[model samples]
Target: MALATSRFLPVLDCPDPRGLAAFYRDLLGWQVTQDSDDWVELSRDGYLALAFQLAPQFVPRAWPAEGVHSHIDVFVDDLDDAEREALRLGALRVDHPPTPQKFRVYRDPAGHHFCLCTT
Candidate 1:
């Protein structure tokens, strides 16, 4: 018999699981698949799922810091349109406007760095 392989799911830990889950829910238009005091799962069409977990000791990542995860990249079809929409949706613009390469970076309400790149 063949060994079963499972797909990987990206899990994010933060102080406020509900807040983080809402951010992603709005940003990605995903619906809440599961919710609890300590965790929440967001999914769309059963293909993409993102999990947010509550971590009492959660320490936000310092992207440019010496030993922290840099950032998460999200590819979009229209960089300008997406940036404008993201700003309207409460994302703080961390970097300057989109460059010629068609990418812009921003920070979520909880300080996680993410980028919008033209795909």
Candidate 2:
């Protein structure tokens, strides 16, 4: 048996919904499909991909620390170029020791961890 779904949206909680959404929007070149004070949604092509919800007392988890549940991994044609663009879009590099060979970790402006990876 399997569950059927129409759409799937992975939402991230941040202090500022629009701000966080903007960061991802710029990073991924996605369009803002919906926006409000406490929530924002982004779409790629024509499908909803990601969303951000306002968390008033949000405390971002530190890299290499406990409480990190999951993170986003983005595939790119060129890792160097993607890294440069991500940095320019307000992403901070998180150079943990013994970094992976296929990907590099980074923290978004809202402090959520993500990876820029190459195929």
Candidate 3:
């Protein structure tokens, strides 16, 4: 049994929702399904969505730090090309040691950590 049944919508908190949303919109090529001053939603299909919510005092979690909640993993075909695109979109590469061969980590403009994974 499940308490609720629905598709997952990942929401990221950032200082500027629109700016963050634009970053992801360009990265994923998703359409802006909804928009507001403090929130924005992007979707490729109605079944799944990604959203950004304004958090004026948001403090981003540090990579390689404990007690972190979650991070996004974007799978792609080419690691080098994906890394290039993410960097072009204002993502800063996280260069900690012991990086896995199949994935590379990066931080978005708002400072949230995400991975460019190959699988």
Candidate with maximal lDDT = 2
Native-vs-model 2 lDDT? 0.89
Quote the lDDT for 105 in model 2.
90
Please provide, for model 3 over 1-77, each residue's C-alpha lDDT reduced to its tens digit, 9 standing for 90 to 100. Answer: 87696677899999999999999999988889999999999998776699999999999876566535888899899
User: Per-residue lDDT tens digits of candidate 1, residues 11-119?
Assistant: 8888888998898898889999999999899998987888888887866665555445756687888877888887877788767653746778788766777889875
How many pairs of residues in model 2 come into backbone collision?
Answer: 0
Candidates in order have lDDT scores of: 0.80, 0.89, 0.88
How many backbone clashes does every candidate have?
A: 0, 0, 0
Candidate 1 vs candidate 2: the TM-score winner is 2
List pairs with backbone clashes in candidate 1. Answer: none
Clashing residue pairs, candidate 2?
none
Per-model TM-score versus the true fold: 0.82, 0.91, 0.91
- Model 1, position 55, has a per-residue lDDT of 86
For model 3, the superposed segments whose C-alpha errors exceed 4 Å read 96-100
Report the backbone clash tally of model 3. 0
Error of 3 at 61 (Å): 1.5
